[model samples]
Each structure stands twice: as structure tokens, then as C-alpha cells.
Target: METTFKNKVALVTGGASGIGRATALAFAKKGAKVAVVDWMENDEMVNLIKELGSEAIFIKCDVSKIDDVKAMVAQIIAAFGRLDYAFNNAGIEGASAATQDCSEENWDKTIGVNLKGVWLCMKYEIPEILKQGKGAIVNCASVAGMIGFAGLPAYVASKHGIVGLTKTTALECATQGIRVNVVCPGVIQTPMIDRLTGKTKEGIERFKGFEPIGRFGLPEEIANAVVWMCSDEASFVTGHVMAVDGGFTAQ
Candidate 1:
């Protein structure tokens, strides 16, 4: 066997850490040329990609900046000749505060990175994919996108917007060779979550127990879902938000 992504090229935003990093490595292992884009630079990830003996580039980018996003995609096209897949996984966990207590800056930051970033990425990336005559895009939304979370108003709103965009984009590209979908992950054990939820052992355990699975998700688990959505294995799947939340939304 050949991997579904063999010979393909993929761009993963937030690829320096956590889920995005895991996904990039997964794609590279499957023989896809991977572009790892993130605001933070990680030498370990870069070294790991190099160790795989696959073509991988680490691009420092603030996904919320339109110019940065454009430049990043341009670099990918220059490197790979065409973009076959994109994981719009760059986003922030906004301040956990009530709507009334949330600052305007919080709102702007969350929407800029989570919503506008995704929009700008697709706006620039779609053309490249169209040029290629076939491509796939998987946006990272959240369970918060599907339901309201009281303390995280900004994050909730941005995620919901992501889901809406995912649906409409998929519909627009249904007749085209491009496929678009969203993945909604819930309570994953990521550095962001660790920082936002608290670092104390007990606090971490409490947070993990919130998920029905009795444990938070691993980055590789979410990466698996993303790779599948980007692969031809999901050729017929589009406009759907597949939840990988350990049944967090089932209830």
C-alpha cells in the first residue's frame, strides 16, 4: 500500500504545535509534501520534518493578517507548484469571560484569527486549488461552533462563523473538483487548553473529566480526522462538520 496522500502536497496552518504539527507529520509520513505554517517557530518540528526525508517548509505567519496569508500561500505554490490540500487550523482560545465582561480586544483577536484568518486563507487558496483542477480543504471549527458556551462568547461566535463558512464553501465547490469540510474538535489536550484551563494536576484532571471519554483528545487523533477529510477516501464527503469530541456533543 500506498497512502491516500502519497505524492500530494498539503499546507497546515498552526503547524508548529499540537494538532497542526501532528497532522503535518502524518501527511509527510504518507508521502505528501507538507508546509508547516505557524506564528511560533519550532526547531523540533522543523527537524522532525527534515528527518522524514520529505519536502517540508516551515513558514512563520500570522494567519489573521491578509498579506501574511497571501504570502504564505504564494510560497506554498512556488514550492509545490500547486496546492492539493489546506488545513485552516490556525485559531486562538479567546479569553474565557461572559459576553458583558469580554473586552473588545478579545472579540477582535478571536474573530480576526479564528474567523477572518480562515476566510482570508480560503480566499487566496481556492484560486490555487481551482487552477490545479482538484483540491481539498479542512477547516478547524469546534464543538463550541455547534452549541453556545456561556463564558466563551467570542470564541463561540467565531467558531460558529467557521462552521457556517465551511458549509457555504462546500456547497459552492460541490460541482467543482475541490472539496471543503470542517472538523469540530472538543476538549483536546493541547498547550492552549492547558494554559487556558489551568496547569495544576487536579485542574487538568478536572478539565479532562468534562469530556465524556473521561480523558481529553490527543493531537494525533484529530490529525487522523483531518487527513481522512483531505484524502480521496472522503471524496464524496463535503459540507459536513465531523465531530471528534469523544461524544462530547452526543449528549
Candidate 2:
């Protein structure tokens, strides 16, 4: 897939770390100019892309806010000129709590970022990609979207929303030169997982046991799926829910 994206532009949100960071570099490696968007300030991400012999820029924006998302797309245009792919990967693993115990703030914030954030990005991004006559989008959901977890009601709901949203949007744009899909990753080894596991040997092992593959997936694995889905190699695929879950979901 190297050089498939030559002279193209790809946008990634929550790209300061983890899967987002991995996908940003993957795009660069494929010769696409990358725009790394994250609420956190991580200069090294952009610097690393430059070191990879690709063009890049960093845009800090809260994807939940319309104004911020609009500005983000605008910055991409200003920096890279056009957009061909997007990975709506900005998300949070909200506080683990039962449905009755989950706070409204937690629910709202989680939904705003994971679900609404993807919607807002697509709302603006589709127009730009339309200008080019063709593009692809991959929204990051999770296995939690397909199944329920006792302590993660909010996260589950938001991701489920992403699943439905992706399908509906894909159908709406299937003939519009834009293909949309969602990725459902299971137990990836990332800062998010670190927080979930409390960085404890026991905590990590407990979660790893959940993976039928017997190991936590690497961020790069998820990045590879997102990149491929956005590539012309996946031209016939759309409205797809891909699980890069190490067989966790199959069980």
C-alpha cells in the first residue's frame, strides 16, 4: 500500500497516542500528508511524521464541539489542501459504572466524544471529500459496541451508537463517492488499556484472559485495518463492522 496515498491527505483524531498515533504514521508511511488532531498537545507526533519523510501538521481540537470540528477541517485544508481519508478515532473509555450508577455527566461526555464526535467530523469532512469526488471514512468503535459489559454502560451505548451511525451514513453516502465504516477493536494494548488495567499485573492479566487470542492486540494492528479499509483495495466494502479483536468477540 506504500505510495498509494501519494499526494493525498488523511485526517486522524485523538492522534497524540495509541491507535490514533499508529494510524497517523501509517498514513504517512503510505505517502499521504497527515493531519494529527488531539485534545492533548503532542508535538513529537507531527515531528515523527516529518522524520518518516511525509508531510504533517498537528491540530488540537475538541471533536465534540461543532466550532472546533469545523475549524479542524479548515486547518486540514489550509495545511494539506484536500482530504481523501478520515479516521474518526477520538474517544474515551469513560468511568466504569453500572447503568443505574452511571452519572449523567459521564454519559453525556462519553457520548459526545465517541458518538457525536464521529458524526460532527463526518458532517464537515464529507463535503470536502465530496469536492474531490471520492473518499473513505473509518470510525473507531469497539467490541463493547457489539456486546455489553456490566461496568461500562456509557461506553457501550456510545459505541453502539457509532455502529448504527456508521451503517446509516454509509447507506446515505454509498452512491456519493464516499464509503463509511466502523472498526471494533478488542483489548488493545494502549494507554486506554493501561488506565483500564490500573497498570497492575493482575489487572492486565484479567483483561488479557478475555482475549481468546491470549494476548492484547497492538495499536499497529488496528491501524493496519483502518488504513486498508480506507484504501482503494477495499473499494467494494462499505457499511462494514470490522472486529480486530484477536478472536475475543467470536467467543
lDDT per model vs. reference: 0.90, 0.95
Number of the predicted model whose lDDT against the real structure is largest:
2
Overlapping backbone residue pairs in candidate 2 total: 0
Q: Which pairs clash in model 2?
A: none
lDDT of 1 by residue, 1-251 (tens): 24567667899999988899899998888888888999988767767877887888888899899899999999998888889899999999888899999999999999999999999999999999898789899999999999888899999999999999999999999888899999999888799888866888888887777688888899999999998888878889999899999998997
lDDT of 2 by residue, 108-206 (tens): 999999999999999999999999999999999999989998999989999999999999999999999999999999999999999999999999999
Total residue pair clashes for candidate 1: 0
Candidate 1: give the clashing pairs.
none
